[model samples]
Target: MKRALLATTLCALPMAAAAEGELNLYVWSDSIDPALIAKFEAEAGVKVNVDGYNSNEDLLTKLQAGASGYDIVTPSQHFLKIMADQGLLEDIDAHALAAFQQVDPKWRGQWWDEANDYSIPLAYGTAGFTVNRNHYKGPVDSWKVLFEPEADLQGKIAMLSYPDEIIGAAQLYLGVPFCSEDPAEMKRVYDLLAAQKPFVAAYTSDNIENRIAGGEVAAHFWWDGNSMKIRFNDNAPIEYAMPKEGLVGWLDSMVVPKGAPNVENAKKFIDFMSRIENATAQYNFYGHSAPVAIDTATAKYTAENAPELFPTVKVEFSRSCSPAAQDLVTKVWTQLLQ
Candidate 1:
């Protein structure tokens, strides 16, 4: 009987492995709700592998370096344009997605994917500063606070490491266009960042919530979603502000890579995520607003109580920079790091 049982266990091992399908998802850290993922796995009989990236540039670099086996990726709108231009994305057949119809029309047919062929909008928010009100006892209502930090706040400010965000914020502070390409304007932006470098506690995008919650820094450049997450979770005295200059808007989308190993599974996963219930769950979990309209009492409360989560000022979404401009920005970023 023991020998028969051993043979049966050995036979079942391969069968169990065969029954498990795999989907590789590359997304921002803590962006997806684990509960929704588990539900998808249970329904599809698939094992989901999640990989995280700190910024859109990180994702672009990995894919450009020929990283493969990534079935799905979440890229901001600007990076989506670059990836689509490079032919690195697979066409998302709208007909194949049952939940595609559920997506808000406002998010579709945007400049990034004009035809709406390669990506689906996931979440949208603005970039701003998260301030520790306990330490800073001022109005805290302008880009000057970050661009030209007060002496006391020196060496206590954390800015995002992302080029587009940091550089664009500087441009806005200078009253120039966010995507300015002229050498003089670009130089001004670079100089601004160089000047602020000494005051910055750290240039980071990951773990910013923890850093802010722990009071490691008094001010940080962060997304509204993450700011909300830290505020609610830690109950810290953190406050999110949209400077009088304006807010930088961003939209993250889901797309399948060119050579995804599990294309069908990726589509299925996208469809699953598009469902209203799942979308609401993700919004509540990640503290970012999804394109899908959800009307729960919690959603209403969030909208009514937390106005900072939604930016009211002019919102500019960054677009793909020209190759020359991108190279210049990259060079400036390298200098800032050094």
Candidate 2:
């Protein structure tokens, strides 16, 4: 009976019979601007509902525990593989979508969804540190400033409480390979972070922009796009670093869950978002690079003044590690936090 119902829904997906409804998007906090959501609702006559998750693990845990009613989710590129393997993702046949062709050539056939069968890429950016130039007048070009700060910078740094990107940053700074199954390699990363804990003012992901802009910390871990918004929009004297040691790259994508409440509306939302006007507005609001190119003429912002969006060094995308490798990362992070 369940199989038959899913098949019926899949058959109606391409038809207009299932267009008007709600689209439930489980995405990162502050992502998918509400104005854009309203714009899509106006165009398609479909109401949209959005929710935010703390991390990729949070998304996985909710779905794994039999939670339902989510039509779409935004998972980082690496977690895409894990969710797909566990059968949490619906096969949307994304390549069939008309706007799929408009996806930038570089973003297509990516490691996460090479065949484009299940996910649509939205935003891509690097995770790095942001520094208040007023607080630190020295060079901001490397992770050295973050981990091995000047004497004055001690006790003036902050970090995200979670290990998702921060652990990757630590690994990058120490020149250690990601997902190292070897305990020794993982220990190096833990040691580096543990040593820097004294200098870290706080380890909280909440209200990072305010903390950085309000002169609470000299340096803090943050994404390039959010940092750009704080610097340009809020007039914060902050520089998002393109560290010489490199940075962690991520692409947040839209993927349907296995038992979504509004699958058709989810696809409609994806296509609508892929359109030029909507994409440009989202980019201007979020300040992140997109897998789909927006209409530059309609764009209100660019990477010209925001050097953070345009990196000079290499960006290594995170990949799903073996269970053992994942355990190493988890243990290292847990011990450091404790």
Using all chains and alpha carbons, the TM-scores for the candidates as numbered come to 0.90, 0.92
- True-structure RMSD for candidate 2: 6.2
Residue-pair clashes per prediction, in order, are: 0, 0
On a 0 to 100 scale, what is the lDDT of residue 297 in model 2?
85
Give the per-residue lDDT digits (tens) of candidate 1, residues 104-141.
88887899988878887889888888888877766667
Q: Among these predicted structures, which one has the highest TM-score?
A: 2
lDDT of each: 0.80, 0.84
Clashes of 1: 0
Which residues of candidate 2, in runs, are more than 4 Å off?
1-19
